[model samples]
Target chain A: GAGVSQTPSNKVTEKGKYVELRCDPISGHTALYWYRQSLGQGPEFLIYFQGTGAADDSGLPNDRFFAVRPEGSVSTLKIQRTERGDSAVYLCASSFGLGADTQYFGPGTRLTVL
Target chain B: TQLLEQSPQFLSIQEGENLTVYCNSSSVFSSLQWYRQEPGEGPVLLVTVVTGGEVKKLKRLTFQFGDARKDSSLHITAAQPGDTGLYLCAGALRSNDYKLSFGAGTTVTVRA
Candidate 1:
């Protein structure tokens, strides 16, 4: 079966610019999540979506970060006025449901704020 | 916020040697999971432990959850070169909590 996939494996942009990262979850997955990983550190939770609505978004660092999954299978993470501090590997994951279900991850999109 | 702390941020061992990585937290969790990640790739699940003081074995690898459910350890016997990667420990606060709190992770290198 096809696993999760992310587009634009790597992206480089200037500070204060905007960038969007896309994620394609595995077919039939009903839950999606976004996380950010800094160099040499573990991934930090960002946001999560159950079906078409965001079920948990407390992990979002600030208002500048937003995500949408209107159709429930695909998600996009948008960053507004990106700062150098936002540079990191953005990872997406999905599961059959939530909770104890195993979450499968994508290769991730490396975002570099220059 | 629940924080997970992993010991020995980095470890290098010769092939056929044994190694252990530990993760601890002040908060109790309903479940804990271990994952292995390689460079340029996403993490892959290794195992999940739900019961306190429980132990699960995978090949030469063993995972143990503390009796208090606030700590866990992963030990590998006779590690091979394929065991080189970053090992991460994550926990869910409740049975229904989808969010996972992860440790900083331990980078392991196995030299052949």
Candidate 2:
């Protein structure tokens, strides 16, 4: 079976720019999540979607970060006016359902804000 | 916010040696999960422990949740070079919680 897949494995942008990272979850998955990982640190939660609606978004650092999964299959993480502090690896994961289900992760997209 | 603390941020050991990584916290969780990640890749799930004081074994790897559910440990016996990677522990505050609190992680290097 195909696992989760993320596009633009690596992206480099200047500060104050905008960037979008894409994630393709496994077929039939109903839950999706996004996380950020800084160097030498573990991944921190960003946002989560259950079906087409975001079920939990408290982890989003600020209003500048937004995500959408209108069809409940694919998700896109958008960052506005990126800052050097925003540079990190953005990861996407999915599960058959929420709660205690094993999450399958994509390789991730490395975003560098210079 | 609940925080998970992992000990020995970096560890290097010879092949065939045993190593253990610990994850501790001040808050109790309904479930704990272990994951292994390699350079340039997202984390891969290793095991999940839901019961306090429960122990699960995957070949040479053993995972144990603390009696209070506020800590966990991963022990690998006679490790091989293939076992080298970053180990992470995450916890769900409630049974239905979708978000996970994760530890900084332990980087284990096995020298062959």
Candidate 3:
């Protein structure tokens, strides 16, 4: 793909509902990342993947938020018992090979929890 | 945890005016990047600074990385109405972790 892609551009769920967001990184990119952005704020790091495994999950807000990249090409972010506070734009990015390189971003999925 | 702080959460200026946005941090970074975002779209990369005290120019924009690598600034000369958007600064952790910490961002609205 020419750039990173995200699925379900917008999502609306009730409180306590579960939701899944998908991310497809650019071809040949070996690094992927997930970020969450609240209104009027910058994107906040959520997790990072180097390959099939997650390299860093420390940024996840809590256990309620989980992300996985089983094949290293596409990733999914799962949120359980969604809260109103979780309403924000979930962003995904990918870099050629990682290691502090520039990252290309996707359009992002806007998740609204009502 | 490394944190980047951007000043003037919101800025509005007239066309032909000049402005500078600042990004400050307490921790040094291996590299820093600047981005511009518009409504309903993802952020687009503007420039990246790797070496300390380095400056890069892109047309009417000038980006500078502080000597300490903990701060950066973006200066725009003779801004135009098209420059109205959100300006963001993100940093690459110095530990080679590949994690990017982004500043809160500065919303600039350049009016004609």
Candidate order by decreasing lDDT: 2, 1, 3
Task: Itemize residue pairs with steric clashes in candidate 1.
Answer: none
How does each model score on lDDT?
0.95, 0.95, 0.93
Share of reference contacts found in each model: 0.78, 0.87, 0.78
Q: How much is the lDDT of residue A62 in candidate 3?
A: 92
Per-model interface RMSD values are: 0.8, 0.7, 1.4
Give the per-residue lDDT digits (tens) of candidate 3, residues A31-86.
99999999988999899999989988989999999999998799999999999999
List runs of model 1 lying over 4 Å from the truth: none
Model 3, residue B97: distance off in Å is: 3.3
The digit string of per-residue lDDT tens for model 1 on A10-105 reads 999999999999999999999999999999889889999999999989999999999999888899999999999999999999999977799999
List, residue by residue over B1-112, the lDDT tens digit for candidate 1: 4389998899999999999999999999999999999998899999999999999999999999999999999999999999999999999999988888889999999999
CAPRI-style class, candidate 2: high
Clashes of each: 0, 0, 0
Off by over 4 Å in 2: none
Error of 2 at A20 (Å): 0.4
User: For model 1 chain A, where is the 10-residue window of minimal lDDT?
Assistant: A94-103
Which is the better candidate, 1 or 2, if ranked by DockQ? 2
Backbone clashes in model 2, listed as residue pairs:
none
